[model samples]
Target: MSAGWLRACALVVMGLFSVCALAKDKQPTVIVIGGGLAGLTAAYELQNKGWQVTLLEAKPSLGGRSGMATSEWIGNEKTQPVLNKYISTFKLSTTPAPEFVRTPSYLIDGTYFTAADLTTKQPATAEALKRYETTLDDLARSIEDPQNPSANNTLHALDQISVSNWLDRLQLPATARQLVNQQIRTRYDEPSRLSLLYFAQQTRVYRGVSDRDLRAARLLGGSPVLAQAFVKQLKTIKTSSPVSAISQDKDGVTVKVGSVGYQADYVVLAVPLRALNKIQLTPALDARHQGAIKGTNYGWRDQIMLKFKTPVWDSKARMSGEIYSNTGLGMMWIEPAMKGGANVVVNLSGDNARVMQAFGDKQMADQVLIRLHAFYPQARGAFTGYEIRRYSTDPSMGGAYLAFGPGQISKYWRLWEMPLQRVAFAGEHTDTLYPGTLEGALRSGQRAASQVQDLAAGKSFEPAKVVPVAAAAAAGAVAAKKGNFFTNLFGGDSDKEPVKAAAPIAPAPAPAPVPAPAPVQAPAPVAPAKVEPAKKATVKPVAKKPVAKTPAKKTPVKKAAPVKKPAAKPAATQTQAQ
Candidate 1:
């Protein structure tokens, strides 16, 4: 052969070898769509599984919904408080609590209960407490046991229900119901509209053996520590990249996120349902999958984080824990300050979330103080600082997390797990049982990672882990907190079903009001206008508490539960459309 011909052959050989080397590595480039716990967990897990990952976050910082909250502290030195540190060891960034405190709050259920006062020392009944313990033990066993035969098949049967249904069945006392509803409301962002399955899963995941011992728990710290762990393994991560389109052909899938393009053997979409719909899929997703995504949106909760200097009022409730109530501000939980002052995270959930989001921090603080004053006269002039985060108006995530109403299981649950072409979906919403939770997000992330792993290994796709009906039923009644999207998705199927979209009935009429507690004169002359700033404390350097070692990595395997078509009968229905 001529010299030119030989050179051409050599070049071709080099190109072929390069391609072979890349294939041998089996390192598929993965682009995680969202940076929330779900997306972060997936990227972290995949990287750990030896995949090349490039996380694309549309927001300016990492940790989509769960990230660090920064604000000036009220102490000698500026302090930063950890907002979410329970999953810290996993792959998030955070600082140790230098100090923490609580702010005063009130219950607006007509009969007010302030964090400062309430004579009910034994708040829970023996039966309720026992049931709570039993449920927790069951869940602890469920998650802790990777090899439990029923580990995979939890969702196939229509076993899990919503919190409301569970409560109704239990016939819990009004006080007990109020407490349970508050917990459920905080999680679902809607008291009466949540799914029993979702509530059960969360209670299991979050409700450990005791209030203090759940899930390698931590006080609220931001996602910095989590991000640190997750991002440390990746070589590159690009931000401000909003993927607009994706197409997959025979060779690989190509994605367009703004000006740049990414090609991968497979593409994993880890965004919220609403954002996923924005991306163009070349081979369209099945209508059912499309319906699930387009139908469900994240729940909204506006945060009014407040700081206080003193614990002036006292009755029985702890200032730094969640207080349940039936009111506009669904629940109020206090966190001790990382600085010298106390921090209170108020959740304005359901329909009122948007209105709270619109109010200025000062106005919100004033409103909160007024409520506290009405509930506890001793709470006057105790406020120090304030801040607010309205998830409804947030640009990055349309809202908080995903919540489904009744009939959602029949229509959208299975569809969320079904893969489409080279496009795979994963996120909290994809989790039917534990939808809209950190653990759920983690589980979904791990699921996506497993799929990507299978494809890379040249193996046929394995089925998802389905939770069994018997096992779910055996555990306990599930909570019923449904949302509007679910009603729209499955309501048309049954006219007899209870409509969850219709605004829930106003909770039991408020109890007769007791005379107000005697007002104590203020020690200092302070105006309500300067209550407190909502800023979270600054980060402080402390000896890092040792991060928890993750459980031994388990071989990715799917366990099958008895599969059957969903029960046709519906218990709940939606009255509202759109």
Candidate 2:
């Protein structure tokens, strides 16, 4: 061989060896599907533990249900430790929860009832409320572990019945029955759909961990702040890149997003079960996993924020706090005063949310105003404008959160928590200890991250058992005696914090008087459309603006159409395995 030819071959051989060595030494890669709390937490945990993490979020921003609204933070003391860890890690600041003076009265059937009215105006209701508090507390205590309440036969029996049926069996009075239904709707966003066991488990989890009455502490900038913190630490994050399919082999997992394929040693599927159903998985999921996904229902609720010239439902109006109504406007409350001033937020769920979804944005706002006027006539014309966030319509998040229907716990709960080969799960739905709450999402993520770590490290992994700590035991005692049934039941504050009021802003010049919207004619309900398997196609990432607190404009209403349900196949079915 010529001298020059030999030198060239030697150099090429050395370069190839260097490339192979670098590839062999690279850290294992993990692809997290979903940028919500669970997804972000999984990514953060994996990254810290030496995994090269790539997070994919279908939405334009992170922090799934937690970041959807800006009015209030929905979490408790248990959430504080996880949140504080992130805040300290990110060097971010948070605002203390706002304190408000709540009126000691409740509005029912157009008439406001005071504390005395409980005995005189509605004696039966008073009796029922007492019974409810006692019964639920006793039931919550029977379950040694909130995460595995099914182990208790009594609790398991309750799981077979809906909350409505349980109340019926108890022979609750009419007003009390209505109040309980309303409370469930406001709290879980599903009045009749949730099981009694599920409801009790949620109650105990909060009672176990919270120091004070449970109240959501607001993150000063909003949930996106925490999301941003997680994003900054991530090695790669592809927002607006929805996963089309997931295929796994003995070697690694391949995630398909549009035309690109990302291969990772392991995968974390953190999206909602409904969202997960959209993606096709090769070597279809087993029967139990498929059944769990098909059986799970995502709860839906609509949040409406009305900016006003003043706090119309303040102490002067004889109603200082949240107001409940039967008029399909489930619950209304004024947010704590902020730098921008105070505003009223109406939460619509259950039948109320369904009724409101038919109208246009402005029409819905008008209807809400009409309902408010019925209770406080003097507050007419104080309305400035409104913004609506319909969780049902969000593409990424099909609904607010998962609500396990009756009989689903035993049939699907275990399957949902079990990991499939190469793919682990994480989300609020997978968490039994604190289901449907922000804390649950974080815990599930931690669990999934641990599982991923074990898998990558070739260690056997088992789901962690939830054991009650001293705080939960002590809190349980306090909750049994002192808990305000209505407030604590709905995961909000029953006691007010001392207020440091913000300076009031000069009311914006009143816009032209908005004429009352024409009454909308209800359309006949149509059968839900059948969802089909997603076609294999490249999905381009669409650029979206960062999530910001902007005023939503009034838009013209269009006739509503029936919402189609997505068709499910075994492989496309969702699993809660995290």
Candidate 3:
């Protein structure tokens, strides 16, 4: 072909391509980076507001850590169940968490310490518990009026010491110390590293953990349900699409997932803090934001499940609960089997997780069995088959919730908590109210949704002001009443450093009341109408008459001649018409 002809053909193809591209540019899309509770919630919230959303999950399913898989045991029966409660909220059915069997004593060093030995049911003799009650009462009152010398100075003083140090200073008995240590372990993973203020907050949150409340506690369907619900509600979600690079301009963001790339008007970084370190961002994060991401830390916790043909019950020791092992597996809880057979789930955390992972499942169980036998001296051979879960190796969560140590709370908590550009951070970790819990996860999601809603609505948002001292104190009071550790930590003046109310902003001059005019004289009333308007009489329309048309006359027929008829007679009457 001639060069001119080839050039003309190329022009035609180019023109057609331009038209197609223009058509594609008319639609707007938003991309969410992760499929955890936060990401899913953000997408769901945006979709409800009539925005188009595309969620990308690195895993085959949604629900990040919340939806991670676990096996549940009911008696001897075993079944794999998704743990998240979002499923039930989406109206999906789920099996309940196993019942809590009352385990009274720990078989530590071949000696059993039963519940009765720890604290007497009598009110007066329990000096340690009495002191605990007194401290809790005093703290609750102080939180209510934090500016009061009793409460305001207490926080400052306690903030200076470690929980372990404070426990030592209190002159607690060995058993009492052990009990306090268990509660600390349950809250912070390690008592020595946790702050005195943190422990005080925990005691305030749980109202001093007692058996009555522990019996009522239950796990929300776990994380799996949340994952499934998120996927089920999304209009379009891409799974197994991990983003490698992100490029952003004032106009929008370009995200590269595997080989495919997407450009979005707004982009939400819904991935966890740990995972964010791996992603490369164009134009780079501001130094402080980068610092926050680099510094965020989470704790590694492990959970183990053991299934058996028979229950490991010890009649002599009357033990069916958890025991604190000095050998580092931390403590083990006896999980009741829900499936009409014998089974158990043992949850271990902190150093225990790290140590157990190194030794593997059987060794960990053997150690637990050894401790169990030492306490009961019976049922040494009770366990049939055991299963273990190591969160340190889990791909999605990596660890449990983020942890902050003494003096660390006052630093970086604010910066890391802020939203970055069009990107917002959420998860249990971001929830100042209930960090590292399902409740916190839900609240963070709602908070993010609110921010995005404000942005979409063209509403202005300033950084959330520091919580007030009085308000914080009030919140602390509630946390103490409820016995919530995280809420107590973040709910009060810990972050805000509250000052007394600034004289209540003095009600703006009561808007100068205008003088009232003289009362006007009343006008005389007119009489009511005497006659009612006649009702429109019912009148059916008359039927219309039918119209008739005139008929037209027919033309006359021509007759054959009579003589022809005579001649036709011979022809068999062929001309009979007349």
Candidate 4:
């Protein structure tokens, strides 16, 4: 062969290799673990970005905790664009909370009072509530950097104590405390179990919206409708496929579920902290990440639906359709009267739910009915049948959502948001803004998708940008002032003038400050950037939560005999489950 000929042959071979490499790089495959909102969202985003994606869910269905029942789907005005994009794309219908339910009628200490009555009936309590709210707003403003909430000394100090302790320190009236505690239990499943910092951060995130507005709107059908829509758009979704183990190398990732193994260029883990802890990760997760998965607490929440032969409370007593209770059952929301009859959804959380679970399903239902009669004498024979859902005992989902205990936030907040090698973590738990919410899950999924894309392209992954709390709140304040229908309805402050909506909601407020290290220390190891071909997969086996069931019968009774009350239990022995 002539020297010129040999040179030309070499050049041709090199050109072919380059084209092959480029093609391989362009079509990276991602494996999404968990078929919940976060995983589905990650898959959707990646697929739209031209990446091949596979989603594996432990449960037979999607939606995770959000799919359990009919409830409101609330989000800040800033998150409207993102939420609307998905809602519109899926053709889902949403209706704002009805006027009757918009402003909750408080049932405090057996007394019913409308929202307007709060200021008039208990002026002192109202003033105290106002002062507490103002304090939270000021603290939220002091948290200039949402991304590093722990950087603030005040917040850090607050993190050292439970929310109950903080409230006690405020010296709120006993009735006011009861009202606040009831609200906290219903929303977060035991404020005493959560850090003050965590509670404060949540307050800041929702500063734009009032407590009533928090349950802003509901999908026409339910959360599952949206979940099903997301499923339809996914290229591949394997239900009842729980990830038992995950192994990643310089080249790609291997996920093992039951007896089958799947390989992809990248992985997105969208499971809750509890579920994530169950999966074995090869190369081992970073210490901080592992600690976070193990240390974080997931709140327990149970829902019981009761169907009646008729609209009992509304027709018989002319009562407001909602009840915030101090009983074992946390709260109840009477659904709009259906053509057939009416239904009341009872929310149980924390220790209350745990205690009731021991009473067995049927007995628990009976107990709840009995309690209902106590509150409403006319309700004695009104209940027909009921169904209960226990989320805490679910194998796939350990709890309703993440709730940070005292000190856990500072130790693991940074780790929750970090990506490990070719794997990225996402879920409401990992999201700082709108934590434990559908909006947070979506935002986290989008973020993980971006990170996975960058990793596949052999580019450095950047942390999600943090929007300033003050700026977002200011925008919300402006919108409230302007009288934007949604904003005015949801945001707490309606008197302010209109201004442009701010950036996406920011992260948790900054924590109390800590002293600087004596000397600068070396930075932690960063996940190396690399990409390689995926290898053949192997199969392994894994475990699943009970869902609330629809009531079958709607029988009613005209009247019933009085029932005995259960003995009082010690509070110390009752632990918050969710």
Candidate 5:
């Protein structure tokens, strides 16, 4: 061969090796230790970062918190930004559910009263209620932002007391106190188990939503559909496999599932706090994390769904279907009846939930009918069938959302956010601003995903910035070129730290990361089409601007016909899961 040809051949071979080495180096491995929305989200985000992700679920199924994936819970940008991002980017189908109740009232004692009757029952009660409201609002205001609940020193006083204690000092009457305790039970835990500041912050979050546009409250197919939609987007996921131990050293981490061990650069521990505390970490976590996990508690919630022979509440003029009571039932409401749909739903929390947890099917059904009879005398005969979903005692899910008692938040607020050596945390517990809500779980997962990415780049961690639907279109082009770790491909905003683009590789799964986002939101039909798509459009503007927008514009007509039909039926089926 000629000297020039020989030289060219050597140069070509050298170039090939360099490219191969770079591809191998750029792809990192992450083991997500849960299959709930938070863990799924972390896996999804890490996959976007060109990382290999393996998700482990203890249960046979993949949906972690299927109870919360109702038609009304998806794609809320202000609260549920992660789901909102999915709704926009993937064009998930969504539909409106009937109002929880038709009447503007609540069931109290054995009589129907206006929602405010408890406070206005008498002059003394009204005055006591006023003082209570004023104190709650004042304390809530002390929380400058949900992100920092203890920003005010005065608020720390709340961390030292329980809601029950706080209420006692308010001088509320016996009836009023029982009513408040029941209301707290509806939330998750009893007043004594909840921190006054924690409860106040939560109240503030709810009050913040007093002005929400209910017209926009829509549901995706359901939580199961959302979970499956996420499953399809991910490359590797395992079910019915529980991790026994996780040991992280200076070099990397090893996660043992059953007898088999999987090694990775980092591990995202995303299980529920109760389950999390059980897992054996080789080098026990820091005192702060141990303390937080030990001190925090989970509330019990049992959803008793009843099917009646007819819409008894509506036909009998029983005042209303919605009831918030101190009775065995904490919060009860009826759905607009249809085939396969339960007529009434009784959500029992705290002590009530615990009581029902030990009851047999017949006992549970009997207890529900007996209590429901007070509001609707015709309820017993009208009852046809019953189904119960026990979230608090689910094997995979230790219980409902985390309930902070006394001062758990002050001592452990930052611990949940802290990352251990080659270990990161994600789940509702880690989210400070939106904890206990689906929004919190999703945001926490995204945050953990970003932490691993930052760890790999040798940079300090930064929280994930949710790209707004309004700004997505404008920011799409800029985000793609910059490769902002948070919103790069799904281009919505430019607030995140930039990372390098996925290195095109021949055999590795990292090359397929770009395609994953295409389907992240295919779970919800219209939320992305209408609400978040505005922001997602920016992310897609880089490449999917045409496909995403074109389909969104047309889905209004198409989604109306096909998607809505399936969506409506799924809404009926899945509402019971919640």
Candidate 6:
């Protein structure tokens, strides 16, 4: 051979180490869409597992609805391994007393009743309530698997009717029904608009739960702490990068944001299913996934986070700041505060949430303040500032969370988490257990991370864990107080029948047209609003204790029609996930 030929052969032999090093550096890549709990969890898991991850969020901040809430409470602790793991891993704190001195209260008209009060003074109402809960527990036991609810094909008939229809069948007392509506109306629509199968799934975990216990298990800083933890560990998070399109070909997936494209071996769309309405998918998602994007039922939530000059509801009034009511003002609860004052969350859910949109924020806040003043005339002047979050009007989060209606669960449950080509799904919407919950969101994220890794390794994807139908039934009847989302592991269905779009059942009367948002200014560009809370104090039911002032986060303002203001800067401003 000539000298040149010999030199080329020598170069190839010496370059072997460099070639191997380059291979090692080229890690499998994934683009996680939506920077909420699910998205953050997926990105965190994948990054730690040696995958290169790029996270995209539409909102100026992350955490999705979790960010908007005053705080979060955990549920079904003993049954959920994922939740336990997250707490220990992050060193998140959980306390038994949620700092409230008393249990929550219920309001019907102008009167207030503690849960104990109802059971004692109104025996008939309490009996009716017990009967209704027992019925739900019995019904929930029929489904062996929530994600594959049709596994108990005999129960499919329930999918054909409204939850209202079923409740009507139960012949519940009017007072009992009103109380049930209060429990459900905010997260779900009027029971008339809800699905019986969907309701049954929620009731599956209905048994063996105590509200005080559920409320006490929350992370000390709320569920947002989990999101903050993920943000700390991930590297390529791009907030405000609203992805407009996603496409996957033979080699990999490409996510588009405005004019830029980020390519990856796979993509996990961790956004709310409804949010897909705004995103373009190349070649389009299959009919099943598309049906979910169009048909998944979510509801509106209006929460006015109010800070009071005193924790009067707890200290002087012997109330827990918990109000379950029939009024337009939904539910209220106390969260931990800095020192002396109480921080209360005023919620209007479902139709009430939609209806309240007609009023300006000031009008809404005034109405809320008046509602509280009507009952607690003792604390009329104790009100401070407030922050309002109307989810239906929020551009980033179009609604609260999943509230599957008649036929939706049966039609799309199996396909909820299945990946199409290179795209996988995550979110509270996709999980069967703890659906629409913080724990569910985190668990789904971990599953998506595993699914992505499996796809790359050419290994079969493992699904969420499953409980046998016989086993679930054995747990017997327990009353569930309230729940956001509920399900057990939902995995791939390669050997199962293909999922199809739901055939419409006659829906209950459509709720009042979702109130059009007042002509309002879009969000102003700002860092996530920081809450300066008053220190938390315990209540003594019989004693009046001094309360420290927990200043409000914003000034009380007069009602004014919100005029849309021109953007001061780009609408999509990036920030750290917290």
- Candidate 2: where are CA atoms >4 Å away? 1-24, 67-71, 74-80, 98-105, 109-124, 208-213, 315-323, 339-341, 378-380, 460-578
Report every candidate's CA lDDT.
0.49, 0.60, 0.48, 0.62, 0.59, 0.62
Ranking by lDDT: 6, 4, 2, 5, 1, 3
Write model 4 residue lDDT over 1-578, tens digit each, in one string: 99999999999999999987676555567888987778888878877766667788776567776644454454324443445557877888887766676555666655566657878988887777666666556545544455556443334555666767666656778766766676776667566677766776666555555544444566766656766778777766676678887876655667777656776767899998878888988777667777877667666677788778776655434445556654555677777765576778887776576566566667767887877767667565767777776666565666668777777776776565667777898887887766666766777787788776655545554554432233433433322334531223222345454443321223323332212212211111111111121332111112111111222121221111111222111111101111
TM-score of each: 0.63, 0.72, 0.64, 0.76, 0.72, 0.77
Q: Can you tell me which runs of candidate 1 are displaced by over 4 Å?
A: 1-27, 48-50, 67-175, 200-208, 215-221, 312-318, 351-362, 377-380, 393-395, 432-434, 462-578
- Local accuracy of candidate 3 as per-residue lDDT tens digits, 1-578: 99999999999999998986664443434677777777777677666655566777676656665522243111111110111234445764444433333333453444445545545442232466446445544444334422121133335334444555545545666655565565446445555555455445444443434443233223334455455566666776776677666665555556776655666655667766667776777657777567656554455555555655556564554435555544443555554455544544555665455445556457777875665556545446655766655544454554566554454443344444455444556676665534555445554565665554444334444554433333334334433444332323322223334333222112112112212212221111111111212131011111231111222122122111111111100011000000
- Full-model lDDT, candidate 4: 0.62
RMSD of each: 14.8, 15.8, 31.3, 16.6, 17.4, 15.6
lDDT of 5: 0.59
**What is the lDDT for 287 in model 3?**
75
Candidate 4 TM-score, C-alpha based: 0.76
Candidate 2 lDDT over residue span 1-578, tens digit each: 99999999999999999987775566667888998878988888877766667788765556677533453353443444555556667887655554432222456776766546667877878778777766676556655566576653334555666666556556677777677667677767554577666777666655444322244455666666666677776666776678887777666666777766776677899988778778877657777677766557556677787777776666444443465654556776656556455577788876576666678878888888888777666456677778777765455666677766666665666455656766889988887655566556776787787776656545543544433223222332333344432223323344342211211122122122212223332211111211212231112222231222222222222111111322111121111110
Residue 22 accuracy (lDDT) in model 6: 65
Q: Estimate, for each residue in 1-578, the C-alpha lDDT of model 5 and write its tens digit.
A: 99999999999999999987674464567888888888988887777656777787776667666553244433345545456567766677766433433223445565555545644655564465455665565555445455555543334445656776666656677655666677676764867777766877776555444322222345555655666777878776676678877776655666776666676777899998778877878677768677766557666666777888777666544544456664666777655554654467778787676656667656877888887787778788778887666676665566677777766766766566867756889987777656666667777888788777656655544433322223222222322344332232122245455432221111111111101101111111212211122232111112211111111110111001111111110010000011
List candidate 3 segments past 4 Å from native: 1-28, 67-88, 92-117, 121-160, 202-221, 317-329, 376-380, 393-398, 414-417, 464-578
lDDT of 1 by residue, 158-185 (tens): 1234445545645565655555565555
lDDT-wise, the better of 2 and 3 is 2
What is candidate 3's TM-score against the reference? 0.64
TM-score of predicted model 1?
Answer: 0.63
After TM-score superposition, the amount by which residue 523's alpha carbon in candidate 1 deviates from its true location, in angstroms, is 36
Please tell me which predicted candidate would have the highest lDDT against the true structure.
6
